[model samples]
Target: MSLHKDHVVRWNGISLGLGGGVWGGSVCVRLLGWTQLNDLEIVLLLALFVITPLALPFVFFQNKGPLFSKWTALVVFLQPLAAFLGGASFFLPAGPLAATFAAGWGGFTGLLALLGLVQLCQMRRRHRLSLTELCLAGALLYLPAGGAWMVLACWGLQPLGFGVHTDLLTAVHFHVIPLAALVITGLTGQALHNRPATRRGVCWAAYRIAAIGVLIDPLLVAAGMTGAQITSLPDLDTVPADLLALSLILLTLLGLRFVVPTTVSRVAQVLLTLSYLTVFFTMLVAGTYVLGVTTGAWTITIAQMIAIHGLENALLFGCCGLIGWRLRTGQESQRSRRGEPCAY
Candidate 1:
């Protein structure tokens, strides 16, 4: 993909638009205090409103072969609509209305996941499961689980007594995890779609490892929330969580270094690189924070962790990754139309 001036400008314009919304919302949430939303909640809401729209392009542009169908398009459009409504519902006083919106979001997310599964099955039948497909499958698999957790949180369930606000946990489950998966999938599709078939074995292996870690980390969190006694390794209480986090970080680094396209613009390259780096940092901090909490070695507040890792994950990884994918895909699409060699 050529780094044309027009493409850069358009990408910057979209980023500025999304970034401005997030910035304005952050300031407003602070000053207005209309809701009891904390910094992380505000960022997550802003991410849903902004980042999900950016991902919509992937629905149309990334579709190829029998892996995706027209039904996938409908699901793509509905997912964000449901998510936006879910985010908007936060403004309402805690009641049935908000719960209904939460359910709506969860239901739509479940539908999207089902469609993704269907596509994954079809791709597998065709013997063409790539890293992008794996990412998409992971996204679909985990998003609804997050949404289910959100629904329970909205219903005022708090079995773990984590001291974090139930609503905040709901937002993290419902928005942050799925958005991260979607952004990663978009980046993978955009970056590797046109690359040579070499290294596919390595890419697929990396994706499977990372995808398992991604899926399991969230499930472990959910299990913790439900007060399930996760069996710990002898003399290593935090081993499971730490291992999952480490696997995700390492696999993400591997993919960024080897799988991502080198032909993208410098700015896009930087953003994509930073997205993975931020993911590594966030996972590291989260793992350490979890160990600190479990061991009582440190008294870091959930609010503090959210303020640091959550903000970085949302802005750097979720938002920037989406923009980077958008720029790369758009350039590739243009090149394709012109019958020029594309970098994929």
Candidate 2:
């Protein structure tokens, strides 16, 4: 990335962040007398406004060659805008109107997922299946699934025997947890993609492990949710989810250990390391909570979970990780263009 390009990306991120902040604040303040939203829902709005806009450009713009087109760019632009409309719809008294706006957001996300699928097919035709591409595809494809859940939540239609609140929670879960993790991991993998053969192999191994874990975690959650209902076994929900969380935590910790030393900027290093460490602790706390659910020992309430895991995932891990990668890569690109020997 050129210095000029870097400025553009930064300006775009800041503008999106400010827009999201203002929109979120106004919706909350104005709609108070109409409908009261929960912490998790507010966090969902923040993830849509604050995180996704910042992430989409950083994650997909680099791959604009095959993955992004003019039409696709329009879709990307519409996604957040639609989400803003959907957020406001929550303040509306009518359920049908709320559901419709939410569906539009979901439709945009579904288009994004289709774009990701197209990218994968292009890669397949080229006989290239890299870890970075897989991560990018996973990140894009997961959004619509979350959007579908959001639509269902808005419609007050719980299909899988889960409550409307749980559907909404699942929407936030997919959007933040898997999507952010995939972006951060994909960006890290992209950084490592240009290394020497020996290190590149190692990088691929690390990325493959972590990416698989991140992608699978959501499926396991859904399976656990459905399985619990079918077999009348309550442990079905927590046991597999807790185990997967543990695996992801270990894999992420390992992946970070491999990638962090390669970062040349001290600021980027600190931020990335902090983001990785934040996920480690939060996932561990989540696993423990699941264990408590299984053993009847101790468990945090849903509100507490949202306050701790939800906020930390979006603010600390997602925001810090994406920005750190942008800084790290920007410095590397500048050094490379200057014909200087790059450290990492």
Which portions of model 2 miss their true places by more than 4 Å?
A: 1-15, 23-35, 64-67, 197-206
Clashing pairs in 1: 194-344
lDDT tens digits by residue: candidate 2, 113-220: 887888788789889887777877878888887888888888888785888878888898888865678777677666566666424466567666666777677778
Which candidate ranks first by TM-score, i.e. highest?
2
Error of 1 at 335 (Å): 2.3
TM-score per model over all chains = 0.77, 0.87
Candidate 1 positional error at 305, Å = 0.9
Tell me how candidate 2 scores on lDDT: 0.73
RMSD of each: 5.8, 3.7
